[model samples]
Target: MKITRVYAAVLALTSLLFINCSKGDDDNGGNPPVQETPTIEGTWKVVTNNYFEDSKYFVINEDNTLHIFYEDNLGFKDTQNANYTNNEEELQLTINFGYGSLLANYTVSSDDLVLNFPDGSISLTKETTALAPDNWIKTLKIINEGNAPWTERIDIAWNGSQLVIGNGYEAEAIGLVNPETFALEGTITTSRHAFAVEIENYDDEEKYIFQSDNGSNKFHMYDLADNTHEDESLPLGSWIYGLASIDYQTIWASSNNEDSIYLYDYDSKTIVQTIDLGERSPNGLDYQAGYLYICANGQLYKCDVSDGLEVIESYTLPDYSITGVAYDGSYFWVYAEKNNEGKLVQLDLSI
Candidate 1:
């Protein structure tokens, strides 16, 4: 009678185990599969181009219209109108002015996107935060170095507390001074013939320095790490009067003669891209926030460098012979030579 009771208990335990296994399989069937997120709609801007150090800052409207603002390396702004359309996988943008439309394949990766053009390509990264207010105020104070006669074209770059000013046309040293008091911090005379056209802090360890002859078509690169300049020089095809470094590896140089902007790769020592601005000679160039601001033929233009190099918006300046341009977070600063005195005008860009 005890052996019979033991067999009956064993059968009961096996029946319970089979029921639990069946319930586990049914639970697995109830789970759902994951789905891909939809592509972002509405207009977008090309805030940065990693391929070409140039930026095309533009806007896309829901109505399929596109606006472009572009500046050559020479500080000339070229404004053009166009239309654009995208189907998530492919994008077709047509610039109505001169050059034909640009067709490319586009891909989205997480929050970042890449557009592959026929000749080259551009990548776009979303902005984490909105830009600060445009409220830049400039106080210009002339400094006299006696008989030395301060460099004609001085490029200014702010480094947190102080501003570094560089002299053009083979100036030996870069001047560091207080932005408010204009007090001299000291001079950096590492390069023997430092044209000091543009100075930019690329990373924690290095700063990029560009210099070119006023008449010649060659530009020099100086690495601030070892305070040494490169042996090889970059050819601009035409005389490079103005330049700006987008990053440590790329530079945008403007040719006054050709009326064009050329993008150069500092790492590989090659010309990667070029934008023809026609007869308008580019004078000064600056990359503010994510837009490439150019002063060309008395106009200001901005481009979306990440969105297939599209021009987005532009405004004509009162003075056509603008010399240089700078953006101090908010306002667009224009330097022009009118009459005998040089004039620095501030333009409001709050809109």
Candidate 2:
């Protein structure tokens, strides 16, 4: 009887082990989810290749033409043109140019881009892809904020389906307007005089930002998930004129009365790096197509973020006081105000 019991116990233990292994192997039942590869038709700055210190950039377009600009260490600049073909299915690229044809393989995961060549591999970082600078054409006029006329130093941002508007002249509230018709939806009141209003969208919720003048905590964060304003003690400084972010934590802000962009650390709540905007006052910024487009000096300046926020392109707007700017995937909406009256303008952008 004892031997029989021992045999049954060993068999049960083996069965349990087999069941556990089977459950582990089929956790997802089949293949895991796959993320889509982002579009790669844009400008890329060479981060690493054969040349270590030389500045190199390539404008890869959908028209089979690649515009190359290179600056050597001796301050010599060269402009080269080449024709290229790509096979997205096979991830292969062939360049036909002056001397001969060179074949390469490329892959883009998230924002990092890699081009593998026959001679050597080139790792490029995206500045702005599939964005044309010259294609920004004005698309009629937009209406005004419904509740009241916009005060001075008006700022604009997009939060989900609405445009959040703020101003520096009033210590009232942040106005939410329809992005299409500019009709007022609602308002989120604040006790501080707000200058910049921006939102950081996460997976499930959004964190709204209401920034003020150079007084105290310059900005206050409001989370949509809990519907509360974190104003007990903000760990940041003042004079934060503009705010934007491609990612949630790496918040980039422009200072008031200064042509400066500061990378704000969320945890530390301090300026991580201060980059010179090369202008007197860089205000009202939005991060679009890997560039920080700032409404400053009566124009929209595209800063090459991959090159230390250097102004690469500027689009002249009307002579009115332009307060804020926002990008809505296909078009750029700018806030132009004069004497408390505001007008939203849509711009069609191209390269």
Best by TM-score: 2
Per-model RMSD to reference: 16.4, 19.9
lDDT of 2 at 189: 66
What overall lDDT goes with each candidate model?
A: 0.56, 0.65
Q: For candidate 2, write residues 1-351 as lDDT tens digits.
A: 999999999999999999888876776435575567675578887888873245477778888888666554322233456889988899888888969888888898656778887667888888844423233323233333333346566667877677777756663667887765667778876666677777773444555464554444456666655547863224443466677866766677777555566777665665677776443566788887677777765556666777555656556544455668876656677777655566666666632
Off-target runs (Cα >4 Å) in candidate 1 are 1-156, 160-166, 169-173, 182-186, 190-196, 231-233, 307-310, 316-321, 329-334, 343-351
Q: After superposition, how far is residue 191 of candidate 1 from its true place, in Å?
A: 6.5
Worst ten in a row by lDDT for model 1 = 130-139
> What is the alpha-carbon lDDT of model 2 when measured against the actual structure?
0.65
